[model samples]
Target: GKAVFDATRPDEVRQFFDGLEPFDHLVLAASGGKGLGPFATLDLADIGSGVDEKIRPQLSCLQAALPTLNRSGSVTFISAVSAQLAAPGVAGIGAINGMLLTVAPILAVELKPLRVNVVAPGVIDTPWWDF
Candidate 1:
Protein backbone atom coordinates (compact mmCIF):
# COMPACT_ATOMS: atom_id res chain seq x y z
CA GLY A 1 0.00 0.00 0.00
CA LYS A 2 1.42 3.38 -1.02
CA ALA A 3 0.51 6.31 1.19
CA VAL A 4 1.94 9.71 1.94
CA PHE A 5 2.43 10.41 5.62
CA ASP A 6 3.30 13.50 7.67
CA ALA A 7 6.06 12.19 9.86
CA THR A 8 6.29 15.29 12.03
CA ARG A 9 2.91 14.46 13.46
CA PRO A 10 3.24 11.00 14.93
CA ASP A 11 -0.43 10.76 15.77
CA GLU A 12 -1.28 11.09 12.11
CA VAL A 13 1.28 8.48 11.24
CA ARG A 14 -0.18 6.09 13.79
CA GLN A 15 -3.66 6.72 12.48
CA PHE A 16 -2.52 6.09 8.94
CA PHE A 17 -0.94 2.76 9.78
CA ASP A 18 -3.82 1.80 12.02
CA GLY A 19 -6.09 1.77 9.02
CA LEU A 20 -3.94 -0.79 7.28
CA GLU A 21 -3.95 -4.49 8.04
CA PRO A 22 -0.92 -6.14 9.60
CA PHE A 23 1.92 -6.38 7.09
CA ASP A 24 5.00 -8.58 6.85
CA HIS A 25 7.46 -5.72 6.64
CA LEU A 26 7.87 -1.94 6.67
CA VAL A 27 10.75 -0.02 5.12
CA LEU A 28 11.54 3.63 5.88
CA ALA A 29 13.93 5.34 3.49
CA ALA A 30 13.14 9.02 3.74
CA SER A 31 15.90 11.52 4.60
CA GLY A 32 16.27 15.29 4.83
CA GLY A 33 18.57 17.99 6.32
CA LYS A 34 20.93 18.40 3.46
CA GLY A 35 23.32 21.15 2.36
CA LEU A 36 24.87 21.96 5.69
CA GLY A 37 28.32 22.49 4.28
CA PRO A 38 31.41 22.25 6.50
CA PHE A 39 31.00 22.50 10.26
CA ALA A 40 33.40 25.47 10.67
CA THR A 41 30.97 27.96 9.10
CA LEU A 42 27.82 25.94 9.93
CA ASP A 43 24.87 27.74 11.36
CA LEU A 44 23.76 26.37 14.70
CA ALA A 45 20.21 27.27 13.79
CA ASP A 46 19.94 24.47 11.27
CA ILE A 47 19.90 21.97 14.11
CA GLY A 48 16.12 22.03 14.46
CA SER A 49 15.48 21.42 10.79
CA GLY A 50 18.10 18.71 10.70
CA VAL A 51 16.73 16.86 13.70
CA ASP A 52 13.13 17.36 12.65
CA GLU A 53 13.75 16.08 9.17
CA LYS A 54 15.50 12.79 9.78
CA ILE A 55 15.36 11.62 13.41
CA ARG A 56 11.84 12.70 14.26
CA PRO A 57 10.26 11.38 11.11
CA GLN A 58 12.01 8.04 11.31
CA LEU A 59 10.86 7.48 14.88
CA SER A 60 7.34 8.55 14.11
CA CYS A 61 7.12 6.11 11.24
CA LEU A 62 8.46 3.28 13.38
CA GLN A 63 6.14 3.94 16.27
CA ALA A 64 3.18 4.01 13.97
CA ALA A 65 4.11 0.94 11.90
CA LEU A 66 5.25 -1.30 14.73
CA PRO A 67 1.83 -2.24 16.05
CA THR A 68 0.60 -3.29 12.63
CA LEU A 69 3.73 -5.20 11.71
CA ASN A 70 3.72 -8.96 12.00
CA ARG A 71 5.47 -10.29 15.05
CA SER A 72 7.99 -12.09 12.89
CA GLY A 73 8.19 -9.34 10.33
CA SER A 74 11.09 -6.99 9.82
CA VAL A 75 11.50 -3.23 9.81
CA THR A 76 14.26 -2.00 7.57
CA PHE A 77 15.50 1.57 7.83
CA ILE A 78 17.56 3.08 5.04
CA SER A 79 20.48 4.90 6.54
CA ALA A 80 23.77 6.09 5.06
CA VAL A 81 27.29 4.83 5.68
CA SER A 82 28.17 8.32 6.88
CA ALA A 83 26.70 7.35 10.22
CA GLN A 84 29.88 5.52 11.12
CA LEU A 85 32.21 6.57 8.36
CA ALA A 86 31.96 10.31 8.69
CA ALA A 87 34.31 11.98 6.24
CA PRO A 88 34.99 15.67 5.78
CA GLY A 89 32.05 18.03 5.16
CA VAL A 90 29.62 15.49 6.63
CA ALA A 91 29.73 16.36 10.33
CA GLY A 92 26.17 17.57 10.34
CA ILE A 93 24.55 14.85 8.25
CA GLY A 94 26.65 12.20 9.94
CA ALA A 95 25.24 13.07 13.33
CA ILE A 96 21.72 12.59 12.06
CA ASN A 97 22.54 9.24 10.51
CA GLY A 98 24.39 8.19 13.64
CA MET A 99 21.20 8.39 15.63
CA LEU A 100 19.83 5.42 13.74
CA LEU A 101 22.79 3.29 14.67
CA THR A 102 22.20 3.87 18.35
CA VAL A 103 18.46 3.32 18.18
CA ALA A 104 18.23 0.14 16.10
CA PRO A 105 19.63 -2.07 18.83
CA ILE A 106 17.34 -0.64 21.47
CA LEU A 107 14.31 -0.94 19.25
CA ALA A 108 15.20 -4.51 18.37
CA VAL A 109 15.24 -5.42 22.03
CA GLU A 110 12.24 -3.39 23.06
CA LEU A 111 10.15 -4.46 20.14
CA LYS A 112 10.90 -8.12 20.59
CA PRO A 113 9.87 -10.75 18.06
CA LEU A 114 9.86 -8.07 15.35
CA ARG A 115 13.20 -7.77 13.61
CA VAL A 116 14.71 -4.28 13.35
CA ASN A 117 17.56 -3.61 10.97
CA VAL A 118 19.19 -0.90 8.86
CA VAL A 119 20.49 -0.84 5.29
CA ALA A 120 23.34 1.65 4.98
CA PRO A 121 24.18 2.01 1.34
CA GLY A 122 27.37 3.55 0.04
CA VAL A 123 27.59 5.86 -2.96
CA ILE A 124 25.30 4.19 -5.46
CA ASP A 125 24.39 4.75 -9.06
CA THR A 126 21.34 6.92 -9.41
CA PRO A 127 19.60 8.67 -12.29
CA TRP A 128 20.09 12.06 -10.66
CA TRP A 129 23.81 11.93 -11.40
CA ASP A 130 24.54 12.78 -15.01
CA PHE A 131 27.90 11.02 -14.89
Candidate 2:
Protein backbone atom coordinates (compact mmCIF):
# COMPACT_ATOMS: atom_id res chain seq x y z
CA GLY A 1 0.00 0.00 0.00
CA LYS A 2 1.26 3.46 -0.89
CA ALA A 3 0.34 6.53 1.08
CA VAL A 4 0.74 10.09 -0.15
CA PHE A 5 2.15 12.49 2.38
CA ASP A 6 4.02 15.73 1.93
CA ALA A 7 7.70 14.96 2.50
CA THR A 8 8.31 18.61 3.34
CA ARG A 9 6.12 18.48 6.37
CA PRO A 10 7.88 17.07 9.41
CA ASP A 11 4.58 16.12 10.95
CA GLU A 12 3.44 14.33 7.81
CA VAL A 13 6.81 12.63 7.39
CA ARG A 14 6.61 11.34 10.94
CA GLN A 15 3.05 10.24 10.57
CA PHE A 16 4.01 8.36 7.45
CA PHE A 17 6.59 6.17 9.17
CA ASP A 18 4.38 5.77 12.17
CA GLY A 19 1.92 4.16 9.81
CA LEU A 20 4.34 1.90 7.97
CA GLU A 21 5.20 -1.58 9.17
CA PRO A 22 8.83 -2.36 9.90
CA PHE A 23 10.48 -2.04 6.47
CA ASP A 24 13.52 -3.52 4.87
CA HIS A 25 14.91 -0.54 2.96
CA LEU A 26 14.45 3.17 2.56
CA VAL A 27 15.59 4.74 -0.72
CA LEU A 28 15.74 8.52 -0.90
CA ALA A 29 16.01 9.82 -4.39
CA ALA A 30 15.66 13.30 -5.85
CA SER A 31 11.96 13.72 -5.22
CA GLY A 32 10.86 17.17 -6.38
CA GLY A 33 11.72 18.78 -9.69
CA LYS A 34 13.79 21.58 -8.24
CA GLY A 35 17.31 22.76 -9.27
CA LEU A 36 16.25 25.65 -11.48
CA GLY A 37 18.73 26.81 -14.12
CA PRO A 38 21.56 29.17 -15.08
CA PHE A 39 22.65 29.97 -11.49
CA ALA A 40 23.46 33.61 -12.26
CA THR A 41 20.15 34.48 -13.88
CA LEU A 42 17.90 32.39 -11.63
CA ASP A 43 16.15 33.66 -8.56
CA LEU A 44 18.10 33.44 -5.29
CA ALA A 45 14.93 32.56 -3.43
CA ASP A 46 14.44 29.53 -5.67
CA ILE A 47 17.96 28.21 -5.13
CA GLY A 48 18.03 29.07 -1.44
CA SER A 49 15.08 26.86 -0.58
CA GLY A 50 13.56 23.39 -1.06
CA VAL A 51 14.49 22.04 2.33
CA ASP A 52 11.48 19.83 1.78
CA GLU A 53 12.38 19.60 -1.87
CA LYS A 54 16.11 19.03 -1.52
CA ILE A 55 18.01 18.30 1.69
CA ARG A 56 16.47 18.66 5.11
CA PRO A 57 13.57 16.38 4.33
CA GLN A 58 16.01 13.51 4.13
CA LEU A 59 16.91 14.12 7.75
CA SER A 60 13.25 14.30 8.58
CA CYS A 61 12.65 10.98 6.87
CA LEU A 62 15.63 9.37 8.57
CA GLN A 63 14.53 10.65 11.94
CA ALA A 64 10.99 9.48 11.39
CA ALA A 65 11.95 6.11 9.97
CA LEU A 66 14.54 5.35 12.62
CA PRO A 67 12.16 3.18 14.53
CA THR A 68 10.53 1.50 11.55
CA LEU A 69 13.67 0.98 9.50
CA ASN A 70 14.84 -2.39 10.76
CA ARG A 71 18.36 -3.52 11.49
CA SER A 72 20.25 -4.16 8.24
CA GLY A 73 17.73 -2.04 6.41
CA SER A 74 19.60 0.26 4.09
CA VAL A 75 19.09 3.90 3.20
CA THR A 76 20.22 4.92 -0.26
CA PHE A 77 20.29 8.48 -1.53
CA ILE A 78 20.49 9.15 -5.27
CA SER A 79 22.38 12.31 -6.04
CA ALA A 80 23.62 13.78 -9.32
CA VAL A 81 27.07 13.73 -10.93
CA SER A 82 27.29 17.49 -10.52
CA ALA A 83 28.91 17.01 -7.14
CA GLN A 84 31.94 15.41 -8.71
CA LEU A 85 32.22 17.09 -12.10
CA ALA A 86 31.16 20.66 -11.20
CA ALA A 87 29.96 21.59 -14.66
CA PRO A 88 29.23 25.12 -15.89
CA GLY A 89 25.65 25.74 -14.70
CA VAL A 90 25.28 23.20 -11.93
CA ALA A 91 26.21 25.44 -9.02
CA GLY A 92 23.10 24.96 -6.94
CA ILE A 93 22.66 21.30 -7.77
CA GLY A 94 26.32 20.66 -7.13
CA ALA A 95 26.30 22.26 -3.73
CA ILE A 96 23.30 20.30 -2.52
CA ASN A 97 24.53 17.07 -4.07
CA GLY A 98 27.91 17.54 -2.41
CA MET A 99 26.24 18.03 0.93
CA LEU A 100 24.27 14.84 0.51
CA LEU A 101 27.42 12.91 -0.45
CA THR A 102 29.19 14.28 2.61
CA VAL A 103 26.38 13.35 4.98
CA ALA A 104 25.77 9.77 3.78
CA PRO A 105 29.01 8.52 5.32
CA ILE A 106 28.26 10.26 8.60
CA LEU A 107 24.81 8.71 8.66
CA ALA A 108 26.33 5.30 8.07
CA VAL A 109 28.50 5.77 11.15
CA GLU A 110 25.64 7.03 13.26
CA LEU A 111 23.17 4.42 12.10
CA LYS A 112 25.38 1.39 12.36
CA PRO A 113 24.17 -1.86 10.75
CA LEU A 114 21.63 0.14 8.81
CA ARG A 115 23.85 0.12 5.72
CA VAL A 116 23.75 3.65 4.34
CA ASN A 117 25.05 4.43 0.87
CA VAL A 118 24.93 7.12 -1.83
CA VAL A 119 24.46 6.73 -5.58
CA ALA A 120 25.46 9.65 -7.78
CA PRO A 121 24.52 9.00 -11.37
CA GLY A 122 26.07 10.88 -14.23
CA VAL A 123 24.28 13.31 -16.54
CA ILE A 124 20.87 12.04 -17.40
CA ASP A 125 19.00 12.86 -20.59
CA THR A 126 16.16 14.28 -18.61
CA PRO A 127 13.98 17.29 -19.33
CA TRP A 128 15.99 19.33 -16.83
CA TRP A 129 18.89 19.27 -19.24
CA ASP A 130 16.87 20.76 -22.09
CA PHE A 131 18.23 24.23 -21.36
Candidate 1 per-residue C-alpha lDDT over 1-131 given as tens digits, one digit per residue, 9 for 90 to 100? 47777777778878898998888988887667462468898675665665787778888888887777898999888777777775787677677777888889899999988999987777777642342
**What is the C-alpha lDDT profile of model 2 across 71-116, one tens digit per residue?**
7789988777877875687776677677788999998998998999
The residue ranges of model 2 lying beyond 4 angstroms of the native Cα positions read: 125-131
- Give per-model TM-scores: 0.85, 0.85
Backbone clash total, candidate 2 = 0
RMSD of 1: 2.7
Error of 1 at 80 (Å): 1.0
Worst lDDT run of 10 residues, candidate 1, spans: 122-131
What local lDDT does model 2 show for residue 97? 72
lDDT of model number 1: 0.77
Clashing pairs in 2: none
Worst 10 residues of 2 by lDDT: 43-52
